[model samples]
Target chain A: MSVSANDNAAKVSVRGVLAKYSVLIAFAAIVIFFAIASPTFLTPANLFNVLVNNVVMLAIVALGLTIVISSGGIDLSVGVSVDMASMIFVMLLAVGYSGVVGVAGGLGAALIVGILNAIMITRLNISPFLATLGVLFIGQSTQQLATSGGQPIYLTSGYAADQFNAIARTALFGMPTPVIVLIVLVVAVHVLLHRSVFGRYVQAMGAQPGVAWYSGIRVPRELSMVHVLCALLAGVTGILLSATVKSYVPLSGNAFLLDAIGATFIGTTLSRERKPSVIGTLLGVLLLAIVKNGLLLVGWNFYWQQVGIGVLVFLVLAASFGLRRVAH
Target chain B: MSASVLHTEVAVSDEKQAAAKSAGRRFGALVVRLGAIAAFAAIMAYFVIFAPGFTSTFNLINVVEQSAILGVLAYGMTSVIIGGGSDVTEGGIDLSIAANMGLCAAVYATLLSMGYGDFLSVLAAIAVGMAVGALNALAVVGLGILPLLATLAVLNVAAGMELTLTQNTVVGASSPLLGVLVSGSFLGISALAWALIVFSAIMIVVVHRTSFGLRLYAVGGHPEAARAAGISVPFYVSFTYVLSGFCAAVASILTVSRLSASTPGSGELLLSVLAAALLGTVFSRRFVPTMGGTLLSVLFIGLLANGFQLLNVSSYWVNGVQGALILLVVAITSFARGSEGSR
Candidate 1:
């Protein structure tokens, strides 16, 4: 009888461990699989390329998404913020504005979207999803109007262009500028979300808005501030993206929206409470970046790479959630 | 006797106050329900007065024909929205609908190119859509993933599949059925418009006049209560998704027929479809999604786009106008509903 009891305890412990770390295990397994399949996958230079060239902008965007999602709101117009900022920034540079001025214009455009979102959600009492979606549509049309029917603005030459390019291309202490920027953002968001009293209030609101209100948390104010911060982060990514490409293509920022949402939600699985977290989101971005890079190295075409990513996302979430169900 | 008289007088005054409050609430509800229709009427009036060719038979028919495919898609979305509840965070949306339509179009074209009969190809394409819906159901219901994330992943998969099959090129097909679907007309209306009407009628019966419809709504409104009532909540939810997939297939057929080709990247219709379905909510007395409301909303959007084009307005302005109009209508309705803004 004792032997059987001991065996049952061992089985329970094994299941608990699996449930707790399924996502991490899946990520590791994929890494090892890629390392075996492609010899260049584990190279330091390739890793650096993945971190700097492939995912810096995505990391920044997903981190911002993590913040809004943790505060019980969704920002479907994050792409709008990115596109607006990139549009304004490039337009300024093409018109002979200095890089600093261009950056300010870009951030201001992004902040406008955030402020609009806040007003619609708080003052007008619109749901976060609908309000942001409306903003996204309006922002798209605004871009089209500004560019006279969706023309791409290229900044190939000039002093402002050089300054803009330096944001992504230049390196300090053997690290790319964009990578350093991403690191700084990750740390800042982590501290803001996990180490501050405001963070606690935001989380409380997210867990239960009614309860948070009853506890004297200013839900509306914090919610507005959260959206503003989220948009600013996306604006930073927009600037980086413009620097990397040396151009602002209309609606290009939408390419990152779905992926960032996917990564942030995937990051939620990393927490025991299934809440969004900065470090987890960073890791999620890394996983996606690695998968994309590895698929390219393995000779899969772009379309197939998308299929791979979709399947991977579903599988990871399923395994983690399924295991947790069993554990309970 | 004097004390009893005084008590009766107080009771009469209290009853009068209660009646006044109820009357005010009813007025507020009526205003909220009629807001979208009022906007629709106002916009139609403006277009008729200002836009050239706004009342021409050709443009009017054109608008209805163009709205047909979207109308069908919106009907499916309405069912899903009703089945999943009115909450945005709930699993009531299918982001993969447009992508599924694109993929089904690709499948139909590929099958035709491979020398399959048109009827057989159409059936196979629809089956693929149903399969996609089932996959979404498995992920969302069985695996317990959030509906938003699950559908988003499926959207990627469907789009990727479409791109892979078509190889980023348009796949054209020719058949008598396809030609008729595009150019054929009946009773001074296009065949596509007829399809829209037929589907709407069918959906009205299925969603409003049937027990299945009631159960689906019950499942969405309160899953726990539904389960307690032995309504098979999972089955209803899964069926709604499958129904949405089927609608996408039908829309795909119309799309492929109209263009005579299945184009890559046809998933861009997602936003317009979502807008139409959400706009439909304002037409409902209880602010829930309804079939009639979806059809009307689809026509309204079509009319707006048509009028803007006729007025020599830049196409870019249409999107902004649509967004602003939706925000305004939704805001009025939400305000009229008082503090229940989260819905």
Candidate 2:
């Protein structure tokens, strides 16, 4: 009986160790697979492009979603904020407005959306899922009305294109502007979430609203702040996207919602306590970005690329959570 | 004698106040139920009065047929939500139903184009759907993945498969079988509509009459209690997804037959399906998903869309209007439901 008990304990410990590092191992394995499969996979130029171009926007949006999810709220309207920012930015530029004014206008519109989201959740007491869903619907429709049935707005003139593109194109210290923006936001959010009283309060409310309320956390106010922060970050993404494309395409921002959600959840696997973290979210973004870039180079069709990512996400999550269950 | 009379008067006043409050509560509940139906009726009446050609028999028939697809989905969604209860668990909701339908339709179309027989194609499509459902069950019930995330992952995977199959191009069946099946009518009703009616009947009986049906509420209401009573919690939860799978398969088949073509965009039906399902709850006393309520909600949306089209409303505003309608209904329901809880 003593021997069997020792064996059981050892088995449990092994399971726990495996669950903890499964996602990290999977990430490393995928990277190795790409390095071996493609000669250019590890090249500095390609890697830089992945960081500066492909992954930056998604990473920023995913980071915002991480905050909301960490606070136990889901914002389906994040994409809408992004789209709204894009719409407002492009429209202002089309009217020959200065770039700074355009940026301010876009951000202001996004802030309005954020504030509205807070009201719906805090004052109305709607569940985050339903409330954001309602916001998503309203936002999508509002864009439709503004754009007159989903027409694309282009900055065709040289001045407009150049002026708008500067936001995305300008480099500081040998890095793209968006990449720099990403770094700044990451640091800010990390500090806000991990090293501050507000962050603790947000997590507390999310962990248990009733308990937090009783403990004097002012649950509604903290929760509302999380949504606002998320929306503002999403706004940043929208502006960057507009700068990249030089156009505002209706519903173009919707893709970020799913990808951000996927990344955030994958990031959770990296958390020691299964909480969302900035580093974990960045790793999640890197994982997705690598898969996307690697698969394209490996000659997979775009549609099949999504399949690869989906299957990979499921496998990684399944392996991690499945082992944790066994350990418990 | 005067002191006794004064005591009796005070007691009578207190009783009267309590009776008044009870009546007010009942009145409020009645208003909630009637309010939704009234709104729906009011909209329909407005359309009939203002839109000159709206009440034509031909238009009405078109509306019913068009609504058949949503009705079928609403039926499945209602069942899933009912089984999930108030707190949807790891496998509570099926976000992949639309994607599942798309994939099934793509597979059916591909097989038919390859000269496969109708029976084989139909069976294969349903098998694929059921297999997807089983995968969802495995993820949520067996593996403990959250229902929302699991189904969402499945959705992406299914969509990817569909895009791969069609190569991002629309796939059509050259066979005349689908055309006939779709276009063929029964006693002035389309076969698709007939199929919907049959499916609804089967669902009503299954949900309301079967032991499996009765166990769903018990499991949803309190899983621990149900388990203590010897109920297999996973079985009922997983079964609802299976039923949903069957429904998606049927919806796919109907769409394939009607369009004679399948596209990746067919997966876009998820939102409308969910909206209609949620709207159904507002018509119920307990705000639970019910079959009759779902059917009515489907009709209401159908009417709204038809009216919009007749009025020459810009298609751009359609989605916004739809979303607004859902938000409004959901808000009202939540308000009523909240009061119910407080009382």
Candidate 3:
């Protein structure tokens, strides 16, 4: 009996390790497969482009999502925040405003959305999911309305074009500006989430709101702050995205919503307790960025590439949870 | 002893508290029904008073015709919400249903254009829809992923498949059968509207008059209790998704027939479908989803949009107005519940 008990314990531990590290393993496998299959995949310039061009905005959005999920809520409106910012920023530039003022206008728009989300969720007792869904619908229509039926705004010629391009294009220490911004934001969010008092309270509230409230944690305030912080990150992403494209596509920010959610959930698998973390989200973003870049180089159609990413997300999640359930 | 006397007093107070709680719950239900009725009346009055041509019989028929597809989608949403377990709002949301409909429409249109008969195309479309339902069940019931996330992942897959099938272009089903089904009217109503009414009636009977329906409500109200009563909880949970897929399949067929074409934009109706279903809850006394209520809400939204268009409001603002109205209704409903609980 003692020997059997020891064997069962060992088996459970093995399953736990597999559940935790499966995504990492899959990430490495994908990288190797792409490197072998495509001649350009392993090139330094291509890889750098993937890091600089593909992952920066996604990484920022996922970082925000990581915090929101850690606080036991979701912000489906994050994409709208990005979209609204882009709309305002581009409209300002079209009217001949300076880039700095345009960016401030964009961030201000995102801030209002964040506050409205907090009011709905905390004050009105709405579920975060439904609240954000409402915001998403409203946001989409607002952009369409502002653009007079959803036309994209281009910065054809002005200081707006030069200054915006420089924001994303200029490199420091041999790295693109967006990559540098991503690194700085990642470190700041990592430290804030892992070491700050507010972060601890957010985690506690997520684990058990009733218990956290009884322990004197200000649950509502922390939850609202998390949403505000998330919106700010999305705002930054909007600014960078418009800068990179030199255009504002109405409702374009919606493309990132599902990917951000996917990356954050994938991040959850990295923790034994399934908590969200900055490093895990970074890894998730890298995996997605690489898959996208690699698939494009391999001549896959745009739609089929989406299909592949969806399958990847589903398989990783199923494998992890299925194995854990069997072991238990 | 003094302790026994004190225990008796405590029991008496508990009985009083329970009585008060039930009373508050009844009041809450009353509030929801009344609020919904008032809101519906207000919308009608606004349209009749402010918007010209809105009161005409022709426009009324047009509104109902426009709402037919939404009515079917809402019926599916209602069934899923009622049959799922606790956390109904989150657990019952099937984001892939609209995308599933798009894929079905794509498949049906493709088959029709390839010289296949109508019967084969319809069967193929439904089969594909059910196949997606099976996947959703595997992810949600079998693997225990959150319903919202699982359906969302499937949504992407379905949309991708649709894009690949259509080559990112609009395709039409231009056969005689589809044309007749869309254009032929019976008893002064179009075939599409008739289809919606029949589907809604069938769903109402299935959801309210069957043993399966009772079992579903039991599971959704409390999963452990249902399990203890020997019901297969996972089976019922997964069955709702299957039913939802069938509804989408049927809706897609009608939609493709009506429009004579299917495009990537077909998936954009998801938010409106969800809103209609949620708004339906306000018409219920217990805040539960019902097919009759869903049909009414769909009509309400369709008419509202028509009125706005007559008033020269941009069609883009329709979505915002719908969303804002839903938020207001939900707020009132939840506030009533909160007050009841506090009482």
Better of 1 and 2 by lDDT: 1
Instruction: Write model 2 residue lDDT over B1-343, tens digit each, in one string.
Output: 9998999998898789767766766676678788878888888899999977999977887777788888887787777777666543232678888998999999999999898988898899999988888887787778777677778788889889999999988888745557666777888877766777777778778777888777887776678998999999889888878878888888888888778787768777987888788778777777777787888888788888899899888766666777777667766666666665554
TM-score value, chain A, candidate 1: 0.96
Question: In candidate 1 chain B, where is summed lDDT lowest over 10 consecutive residues?
Answer: B334-343
Lowest lDDT sum, 10 consecutive residues, model 3 chain B, at B83-92
Interface DockQ per candidate: 0.70, 0.56, 0.62
Residue range B125-226, candidate 1, lDDT tens digits: 899999999988888788777788888889988998998898999999877778888889899888888888889999999998999988988998899999
Q: Comparing candidate 1 with candidate 3, which one achieves the higher DockQ?
A: 1
Q: Once model 1 is optimally superposed onto the true structure by TM-score, how far is the C-alpha of residue A7 displaced, in angstroms?
A: 5.9
Error of 3 at B330 (Å): 1.0
lDDT of 3 by residue, B12-44 (tens): 998888787778778876877798789889988
Per-residue lDDT of model 1, residues A1-328, tens digit only: 9999999888877876786677789889999999999999999989988988778999999988999999888998899899999999998888888888999999999999999998888778787887888888898899999989899988878876697767867888888888888888889889999999989988997889899999998888999999999899999989989988899998888888989998998888887788999878887888889999999999999989988888888888788777676666
Model 3 DockQ reads 0.62
Question: Candidate 3: where are CA atoms >4 Å away?
Answer: A1-9, B1-25, B86-90
Regions of candidate 2 where Cα sits further than 4 Å from its true position: B1-27, B86-91, B174-177
Give the DockQ-based CAPRI class for model 2: medium
Ranking by DockQ: 1, 3, 2
> Where is model 1 chain A poorest over a 10-residue stretch in terms of lDDT?
A319-328
lDDT of 1: 0.87
